[model samples]
Target: MDHLINHPGILTAFSVIIFIMLLLDLGVFNKKSHVVSNREALIWSVVWISLAMGFSGVIYYFMGLEQFTQFQSAYWIEKALSVDNLFVFILVFGFFNVPKEHHHKVLFWGIIGALVFRAIFIFTGVELINMTYLPEMDLFGHAARINVVLSIFGIFLIVAGIKSWFAEDGDDGDKDFTKSPGARLVHRFFKVSKNYDGDKFFTIENGIKMATPLLVVVAVIEFTDLIFAVDSIPAIFAIAPDDPFILYTSNIFAILGLRALYFLLANFMYMFSRLKYGLAVILSFIGVKMLISPFFHISSPVSLLIVGGILILSVAASLLFPVKE
Candidate 1:
């Protein structure tokens, strides 16, 4: 913590490194925007996700499993939450009639926005916690307590889950979904082009067509994740709250793979209708846990096990009970 804080320049350097790497990813690896074939998407997806997990091994070897446990829990949880985001993406994409060819571009920009948000949230969260000098994480002047903020997050997810469960279920369970604040605000503040003209986000209707409905989908994708920060950030703070480096780096990398994950799983998304219910349970459970965590002594490792177990079982169950049947 002290080393990272003292050498704050490392964070900037890290961002620059990520940028250069992204340049390489797009420029060398995927210069021409080809339809992300399953084989290609899978390869890149595996490479990135494996790298993230490998980083977790590094954390475990150095800081211990408790810390590694926290990262795994956060990474898995965020990945799952992003699944919900995908449900929304499918909706927004369908609504806008975005072309398959242009989908990658939209996702690319949307992911860039997510990276920016994570950087800010993790940095500010750590700085604020440090400044407080609260022996533990005390909001005001007391020991860290799961105050109303946490309860609200818990209840909000519960309600969101129930709403998702019952909301007008479209083909295979893609409901009208938008949990991202940015998406909502943009939808409210700006007028959207209703029809998609090829890959354009905006069209002049007579002659010229701009980026079109595609850009809106991308923006909505970006915004859809705001509420995610609300849930996962606190969840992470629950584990190794002081290590800002772990929190931010793990989150940044996990998200870096999301676009690839999306393309990789795009068509098969319909098979996982049961996943929403599972994620709802997980989110609601975590929210409640975060709310009550202050009262009880739930160790990070235990928290990790419960979360990981839930994810594995949920996946197994979803596969066992397919939506087609």
Candidate 2:
């Protein structure tokens, strides 16, 4: 893993491939503002999943079974976490009354921002973990000294999971973007249009540049992604704390498919009523695993199976025992 991360070529190649794919997605495949059909969303969903698995196959061939399993575990964790993001996205778009045709545009830019921010979060987190090498502080009652940063992340995740598990879904009417710090900051710095201008983020009016509501939507989505990344970045670190290559590549791939996944499942989100519980359980499991990692090392394969099983059972339960209208 250290060797892979130290190799600049591998990192550069992956980054370039991701950029090219994004360009093609935005520049070629989706050049117009139109509602993405359910069929199109479904097709793209399969394509993205196939592409991710294909990359996993490459990892298996080049990095062997262990790293491949690590990548799979991180991918599943990030993908599952992304489902929670989609629920918020639905709320944001509905709140703003963003046109259906413009959803793709907002998501496309939101994902681009996510990639940049996630990289920053990963590098910073890894560095912080590395800096906690204090030989003087022999803590945690274990043979190896406990990493304070990792411990903090584990506790945060466990607490967050518990809170999410018990938190009731709030009414959408209660959400007020104007009150959000991010929204307030954006509004203070830029002049925004009263309405959307056909998916455009900016337009010139009276010799001054003004942002459209679409820009505000993108800003809110980006801020929301940053919040989600706080949870997600640490979860991946728990899976593969030492391997930034696996951590980053898996995160990017999961995010790459998120736009398609959102559209594919948005209408059907109600059917998966138990997904939040599954995510809560997964987060708590990983948190506990991180906390006890000195005493117990969960294999990546086992982690993958446990996570996959939780997701499956949650979906099955949702469908079998749906809330009555």
Candidate 3:
């Protein structure tokens, strides 16, 4: 497979688009911390999704159909898996009693952290995968090279899928987020104030500068995304394990849109009550794909169709079978 990174023009285009969007997102549109309305969230969601699809078109133009489908598959997988992250974000905000106005700021910073961490995970994972390919040998009459890392990741994702399938609702709702390692890491390093001071992450109380609950919230969010990546990153690896460029670009585009998505869906949680089941199937399907890659290749187009179909069905089921309030 040809690596997208080899195309300098495409790389430049991807970088420029991301840079400009983020600049507009933080430096311009959201310059002030204010309550984001549903309309605004909807508009931004459309903008981001359109940008992602447009960029995928660019990929198809330059990298051909295979890479385009790879991008689509990875992008949707990350987007689907990330719904679970939004659920946690809601709980975290509620736990901290975070003011409605500050949710975007928290999610923005959380995504920035994700952009960096995901690059590290995807690139490092690709190199590890390259190193772990077993010597080719006959396995049931066909010679194939199996990657040890991908095999382990496959098993892990399958287990994660099963766990997600049977997972109970409100599992994290009643837990104390203050006990989270993310919060503890913040408390160990800085004196945290008892109250918030506007949208500031730091506050001065009694002539002492201290971290506010808002900062603790960001830390928790960052740590939460890192943990979520354990599943999400590996799932994407099942799509384009050898092409870090495809993996990272698609993973980032999906993540960049999540803040808007969170706001848009925050009030419509019941509409996706059945999404976990769909995500479980997607994860297990990707895991099985990875496990079988040595014996049979699943074309990216088929993978894209399956993933898109599952997502559509999940949302339709959620609407039709509407979870009783």
Best by lDDT: 3
| Model 1 ranges off by over 4 Å | 1-17, 125-148, 155-168, 171-211, 227-235
Better of 2 and 3 by lDDT: 3
For TM-score, the strongest prediction is: 3
Instruction: Give the per-residue lDDT of model 2 (tens digit) for 1-325.
Output: 4335755665677778788888889999899888999999998889888878988887787678888888899999999999988888898989889999999999999999998898899988988988874464334555655677888889999998998798786544468865656567678889977877787888888888998888888888999899899888898888888777789898999999999999987878776788888899999988988887765689888899999999999889889987555
Give the clashing pairs for model 1: 137-144, 180-223, 200-211, 200-212, 201-211, 201-212, 201-213, 202-212
Q: Worst lDDT window (10 residues) for model 3? A: 316-325
lDDT comparison, 1 vs 3, better candidate: 3
lDDT of model 2 at residue 208?
86
Error of 1 at 19 (Å): 2.9
Please give the RMSD of candidate 3 to the true structure.
0.8
Would you list the C-alpha lDDT of every candidate in the order shown? 0.68, 0.85, 0.93
Q: Give each prediction's root-mean-square deviation over alpha carbons.
A: 4.8, 2.1, 0.8
Tens digits of per-residue lDDT, candidate 1, 1-325, equal 3333344555566567578768977788766556778887798789778877876776666567677777787787777777766666767777656777777777777778888888788778766655543235755554664444445555766676576566554653444534445446556755555666665556675554433456556766776667557756665555555777767777877778887788866867655667777776776667667566666667767877887787777777778886764
Against the true structure, candidate 1 has what lDDT? Answer: 0.68
Clashes of each: 8, 0, 0
Q: Give a tens-digit lDDT track for model 3, residues 115-141.
A: 999999999999999999999989999
If ranked by TM-score, best first, what sequence of candidates would result?
Answer: 3, 2, 1
